[model samples]
Target: METANRIVLPAMDMNVSEGGEIEQTEIDHYVARAKGGAGLIITGACAIAFPYGAASMKEPGLSDDKYIPGLKALADAIHAVGSKLCIQSTHHGKVARIDTANDRPVLAPNPQDYSYSMKAMADCTPEELAKMGAATAGKQTTFKTMSKEDIDWLVETWADAAERVAKSGADAIEIHVAHGYILGVFLNQRDNQRTDEYGGSLENRARLACEVISAVKARVGDSLAVIVRVSGEEYGQEGALSLAESTEASQLFEKAGADAIHVTGWGRNPFDNFTDGPLPNKVGAYVESAGHIKKHVSVPVIAVGRMLPDVAEKAIKDGKTDFAAMGRQLLADPELPNKLAAGKPETVRPCINCYLCVGESFFDDTPFCAVNPSLGNEKVLPLRPTSASKHVVVIGAGPAGLESARVLTERGHRVTVVDKADRLGGTMWFSTMTTPDNERLLRWFKQEIKRLRISVKLGTRATGALMRELKADHVIVATGAVRPKPDFPGGDLPNVQTGDTLRAMMLGTATAQEAGFVLSTLGKTGRLSGLTKSPEFVRQFTKYWLPMGKDVVVIGGSLVGLELAEFLVERGRRVTLLHEKQQLGLPLAMPRRWTAVKDSEAHGVKIHRNVKVDRITEKTVEWTEGGESFSAPASMVVYADGTTSAAPFAAELEAAGIAHDVVGDAGAVNYIHGAIHSSFKVASEL
Candidate 1:
C-alpha cells in the first residue's frame, strides 16, 4: 500500500472462476501483475449473492464464508510481493448480463426493458444480431422494482462482503456503482422513477449508495479503505444522470464515509462505451469524468480508460485524480510502471485499445489481452533464463517473427531474424498506417529489436542453404501470410494486383519485386519506360498510377478488403468492394470495424455483398448479385479475399534437416492475436 506507485488495477470481470471459486489461472494472473509492480491490485468484480443480479456466469463470489478460502488465496498471493490488494464487491442489478434467477424475474429498481446492444440490431447482419440477442437471452430483461427490504438486504450483503474482504487480508473494498449496474441505475433519473423515499430526488436516489458505503465502513472500521466507483454521467437520454447530480452523489458518498472514488461514464452510443471501441480519442478517454468528480469529493479519486503514464502523471499532478487506474495497459505490459520509474518509458509496450480484451469477455468471458499473450496463462510464462542457450534462426520480420526472436533471446538464445522486405514491419506497415495507435507499437517493436541487438537481415530471403549455413539449433518459420491468390477467371490479367501490393505501391514504398513488376509494365512502349530505373523517379511516377486507374474494383470482403476499401476511398478514388458476406466488416474489432464501415460508407464506396464474380476483363468486372448479372467498370482489380499460407521455405528447411516450427500465417492464416500469442508461447519454450 505504501511503496512503489500510485497506479491501481481496477476491477474487471475476467470470468475464469469455477462455481464461484478461484482457479490457478486467476491466481497466476494477479500474482504476475503484483510481481510486476502495481501499487494496488483489485480482484475482479466479485458478486455478493448468487442466482439473481449476477453480472457474469462464474464471476468470483462472496455470498458465503465458504468462498473466503479462495478469496484468501488471491489476497495472499498479491500481498506476497509486498503489494496491497483491494476486493471489489458488486451486485449486477439491472445491468446483469447472465440469467442466474432460474427463469424468475431479475430484481431491479424498475422494469429493465432493454440493453445497449438492442439499439444496434437494425445495423447488424442476422448473425451479428443473433449474437446481441443471445447476449441478453433469459437475462432478466424485465425487473420488479426493489422493495425497501430488498434494498436493505442488498446493502447487508455488500457489508458482509466487505467484512469478508477485510478478513481475507485485503487492504480495501471498492463498491461498483457504475456502468448502469444496480447502484448506478439507482443514481440515474431515467432508470429510477419511484416516488418512494428511496427514489425520485437526487438525495433520495443517492441514499442507497451512501448506505452501502456506511455499511461497509461500519464493518471494516478504519482497517480498510472504502472506494466507490460511479458513472459521472448517464450516457443515454439527456438529463438522465447529470454531472451536477454525480458531484452531489460524490459529496454524499464522502459524507457517508467513502474513502475514494473511481470515475467512469456509460456509453453515449451503444458502441461507444467505457471500453475503447468507438472512442474518438485514446489517451485521457475519461479524464473529464474523474476530474469533475475530484472537484467535489474530498477523498482520493482514480481514473481509468486508456490513461497512459504520461497522461496519468499529468492528471495526478493537476489533481484530476489521486491515482490512475489502468486495466488494459497493465495487461499489455505489466512493467509499465517499472519502465516509467526507471526512466526507460520508451520500452513500455502500449495498449492499442483495440477492444479485443473486452470483446473476448463478451464472447467467452475469459481473461485475455490482445497485446499481452501471457495474461490468463501466466503459468507458462518464463521466469528465468533457459537451462541451455542455443542459436535460433527466425524467418520473417513480421509481428510473429520479431516476437519469436525477442522471446528466444530473453531465454538466452542467440537469435537472427530475416525478412524479404526491407522494412521491419511486414503487413503491419499498412495496418499501422490506418490505426495510428498501432503506429506507436510498430515504433516500439523496431526500437526493442534495436535494443536487443538481435541480428536482422532485411530484404534477405531464406532458403535451404541459408538455413544450413546458419546451423541454428532451432528454426522458426514466420514467413507471414501473403495476399490470397486470384483464382477467378481472368485473374492473370495485367490490370489485377493484390491489396498488399496495391497498398505498398500507393504508399511509394513497394517492395523491390513489386516495383520491378510495375515498372516493367510501361517498358518498351511508353515515354515513362526508362524512368523506372530511378527509385525517386519511379516512386513519383507511380502516383500517376499507370497500371491502376482512377475507377477501381476491389474484390474481397475480409478485413483486408474492407481496410483496402477504406484506404482507397479516403484517397479520393472511386471504389467498390465485392465480397460474399451479407455484411462486409462484421467480424472485425468493434472500434476498427466501426471506423472502417463509417469511412467507407461516407466516401460513397459501393459495397456489393453476396456477389458472384463471373469474370474479370482488362477494365471491367462482371459480377452477379441477387440473381441479376451486372458489369462494373474498373481500371484495375485488387484482390483482398483469401485465407491461405504460402511458405515455400518449409520444404527447404525439411530437406536441410533443420528442426523447424511453422507459425503465424505461414502455418495457417492466423490473425494478429493468434499469430503473436502462439509465436510468443512457442518461442518461450525454445
Candidate 2:
C-alpha cells in the first residue's frame, strides 16, 4: 500500500457471518469504510481453522476454500471505491475453550491447568502441564503445531491462505499476533516457557512469529504487503516483553520480511501503560511504542491508540510514526478521513470510550460504536443521507437533544434546537462538573454543536405558540426527564433537600448561603464559608458530600451512592453506605460493578446492605440494618439516590397542547448511552 497522509482502518471484530459465510451486513460495513475514503480497510479477525481458531461461534471464518467467494465479494465492494482492503488471519490459543462436544482440545504455548477452581499458577499437576506442552508441539488437535516436518505444512497453510486472499483481491494481509492469541503466546514469556530452540530467549520466543511471516512472504512474494500486529506490553507479569524487547521482536519480523508493524497494548490489567488513562491516553500514547520498534526496523510503523485526525496528523507530521491505524475512531465515523480531507472535520462523531463496542463483541460477535448508530447496522442503515429536507424542532439541549439535532441536520433537515436552560448541555452541565476527566465529554458536545451550526435558542421552552410560529414539520421532544423524589417523612423540612438541589448549590447555581438554614444545618459554620470556597471542594462536596466532613452516612447505595461513599472515604471522610438492596450497583455490569465494590472496600468505605433509612433529623439519620435500628450523626446528608426531571416545563408543554418528547432524566433516569440513543431516535424520526 502507498504511504499517504491517510489513516488505515484497522480490523475490529464485526460479527457478520453465519456458517462461516460473509453476510451482506459485513460487505456493507466494509464498503462504507471504503466509500468513506479510508486508504485501507482491514477486515475483522477471520479464523484460520474452524472450531480451534475461532474466537467466538459467530466470528467469520476463512478456514475453508468455500469461504473465499464470500470474502471476494467483500474485497470487490471495498475496491470499487478505490480503497485497498486487508484480511487479518487469526487463531485463538488458550483463550479458546475446548468443548468436549466440539471434540477439539484448546492449544497454548504451554499448559494452563487453571480453570474455575484454580486461583494461581500453582494449581496445575505435572502430568497435565506435560500434556499441555506436548499438545502445543503438534499433538491431538486437527490443526497441529509446526514440527520440523510440520513446518512446511504450517507454511503451506499460510501460503495457501495468502494466495486465496490474493485471489479474493485484497491489497494486503495482516498476521494477528496480539491480544494473547496463538502467535502472541509464542512471543510472550508468560505463556511460552519452552526451554527448546523456539522458546527460552527473546529470539527463540519470536521464532514462530518470524516463521509465519517468512512463510507468508515467500508464498505471496512482494505481491502484497504484510503487517504484524503486536501487543507492546503484556499487563500482569514481568516476564512479558517490554517495548525494548518487542522492538527486538519487531526487528526479527522485519528481517523475516514484514511490510509494516501495527503496535498495540493489551492484557487484563486496567492501569497498564497505553491501556488505561483518560482520552489523551487513547491518542498518540502508543506512538512511542511504535517509534521504539521503528528505530530498530526498516519497515513503516503504524500507531494506534484511539487516534483522532488531529492527533494522528500530529504523529505523522512530527515523524513519530509513518501511518495511523484507527479502530474506534473509524467505527465512530467511517468517513473521518474523507471529512478531514474535505475540511469538514466537525461532521465526524467522536468515540466516547464507553466500552459498549467491547461489550457487544462478547455477545454479538461484532463490535458496535456507541456514538455511531450506523455501526453493526450497515446492512440496513445507509451511511449517506436519504431523508428529504424538512424543518425539525428539537426541544432540549441535553445529550439526546444535541445528538438528535446533529443527526437530523445531517439528514438534510432544517433543525432548530431549543433548551430551557441558558446553555446547550442540560443536566450534563452539572453532572460533568463532578469530575475533571468527564469535562472532555462536555467539550466534545459543545464542539460538535458549534460545528454542526444547528441554531440553538438557549433558555427558550418549547410551547404551542412557538411551535405554530415556527411551523416545524417535525417536533422532537428531547426535553428530557427529571429525578423523582417521592414524599418521605420530614422531606419538606428546611434541612432536607434532593440530589439536584445539592448539586446545583455546590455547582454555584444556587447560593448555599441563600438556601435558608439548610446550609447552616449541614455544618457550614457561616454563610460565605460553604458558598464561596474553592471550586475543587465544591465539586467534591457536591458529588460526594459526605467526605467533606469528619463522619458521614450515605443513604441508597446504588451506583451513585457507592461511588460517593468510595470518593468520600478516599478523601479521608468516614463513610457508611446504607442500602435497602441486597447488593450494590445492581443495574451495572458485573465486572465494572464488582471492580468498583472491591476498590471501595479497599478504601475503607463501610457497606451495609439490606438497610433502609427511616428519617433524617437535623444532625442525625435513623436507619435499620439487618432489621436492627441504628442511628448515625451527620455533618451533612448527601443523596446519591439518582435524579428525576426537575424541569417544570413538561407539565406546561402538556397543558398547552404542544407536541414535545421527553428524554434522559425527564423520560426516565438513565446513563449517557440512554440519553444519546434516545435523542438520536427522536431526531431521526423527526
Best by TM-score: 1
Candidate maximizing lDDT: 1
Residue 303, candidate 1: how far off, in angstroms?
1.0
Instruction: List ranges where model 1 is wrong by over 4 Å.
Output: 1-3, 113-140, 236-240, 268-281, 489-495, 506-552, 571-574, 590-605, 617-622, 630-636
lDDT of 2 by residue, 1-686 (tens): 77334688887877668766888888888888878888888888777665555655556676678888998898888878888888988777655533222556555666742223222212123543454333233233433343555434545666777877877878899997787677887888877777778788999989888888998898888778899988766665556667877888998998998999988776433222223311223456677787777778888888877776787888788877888887777887788888888997766666655556754443434665556767878753553473578777878777778788877777778889887655666665544443343445566677877877889887686777787788877667776655433255544444444555564454344445433444434434422454423434455554455324577777776656776677677767877777776667543333345455666778898777777788877777788777789887776566666455544665766686666666655566666667776666666665
Total clashes, candidate 1?
A: 0
Please list the C-alpha lDDT of all candidates, in the order they appear.
0.75, 0.68
> What is the TM-score (0 to 1) of candidate 1?
0.88
How far residue 43's Cα lies from its native spot in candidate 2, in Å, is 1.7
lDDT of 1 by residue, 534-563 (tens): 334443444455554578898887677887
